[model samples]
Target: MSRKKTNIEKEIRALKKRLAKKQSRKRKVRIVARSVISKSKTVIFDPCAICGVREATTRDHVPPKAIFPQPRPTMITVPACSECNNGASDFDDLFKVYLSMQATGKSEIATRLFKERTVRTLQRNKSLLAKIKAESKSLLVENTEGESEEKLGVLWDSEAHDHVVERTIRGLYYHHSKKVLANDAELKVQWLKSIPEEIESILELLTEQVIGDDQVRYKYYIAPEDPRHSVWLFDFYGAHYTSGYTEPTDS
Candidate 1:
């Protein structure tokens, strides 16, 4: 029975992976179009999704392909420029936060937060979740290896306890979120309330650390090539916000 259950879980994960890939293509196209429209003088400037850098020159996906492997809006992309986008590629920092949230079992919330249109809110959530994951991982790694015995400050026995470490980190986060959910009145009022606001707070703190300020300085525009797609222009501004990411910013 346990083996059967494991297989079923694996199959489900595979399906989700395929779905994410399909969505990634769509998101990429959408963002491309939006960039063109924004350049046509249709809209205004907004903060970059990942780094909070204003006057963004590109549209980069948040949660990165490395962490999630597929793209959805929340899982899809963010407003960034060439510099920040390149920086994000080297590290899956934001995606790690979402992973931590998932490992902690706020997986649903983590999924929803990234699908948002607003970069600030998305980053806020991503940063908080990342911090939570990092701390939880550290604590677990520490307690398990009996670090007190060694004079070394670092937890050396990480790989030896991979499953336990991962589970402990995720479980702790889930438990904390569950507690918050229990006490949150608004959450009870609204079915599951919105995780975006909570995530926003997380990103705000993270931005201060990574980007030096919580302010994003990018211009958002719709795609010019495809009118149906919604993409944001990083450096240039257009007249209107499109429904999709790939629409041109100049049109």
Candidate 2:
């Protein structure tokens, strides 16, 4: 083949690859629009979800309220002591700011939170903004029209992000079971880029719950026979997601 023809063929192949990837991502991540009926409650249980050692006093919003825009959707708040509640605020703030940045334009609520609330918060805290910017990554993503585009993606702060996900799962386990897991309970957390069909099917079978204007939802199944083993799937901003499994540890 001539040089020009070969280049043309390469470009065409690249275009096809980009288009397929875009469609796959959309198909994998699209949020379920309908709501599922539920009877689960964030009951004022005796002990805090976080520590299980302290008396429950304050309630902590799983995923935190800071991430949501004004007139936020229904929240999932679990019983928590003042210590666990107060200590995780920093991690919640980190989770909120970074995830909001990543979710802008994914939905009207997300857009508003990103362009208005989150931006304002970051603006007022220039140091935090600078810090986030420093950590944020510039990534190459394919756009709808098969063009490569630059995107600012959150480089999840591992310690903070893991804490948020694990905390959310623990709260959720308590939310469903109305029982507390031991502090040494083992929680294996995974942040998802997209949900696999197998996982989606499993989630569909679990008890589903939604909040945050339908932007945040999770499906969980705690083995009736074994409270120690539980499954959790968390979706945020209708896009970002995390899945986790928890069981009692030997320790």
Q: Give the winner by TM-score.
A: 2
Cα lDDT of model 2 by residue, 55-87, tens digit? 778998886787888887778789888998999
Across 48-160, the per-residue lDDT of candidate 1 in tens digits comes to 43333334577654324333313322333444657656754424444333333333222443343334322343465676535444554332223346664322122222221
TM-score per candidate:
0.22, 0.76
Off by over 4 Å in 2: 1-45
Residue 91's C-alpha lDDT in candidate 1?
Answer: 41
Candidate 1, lDDT over the whole model: 0.29
Candidate 1 Cα misplacement greater than 4 A, ranges: 1-46, 70-74, 93-251
Q: lDDT for every model?
A: 0.29, 0.69
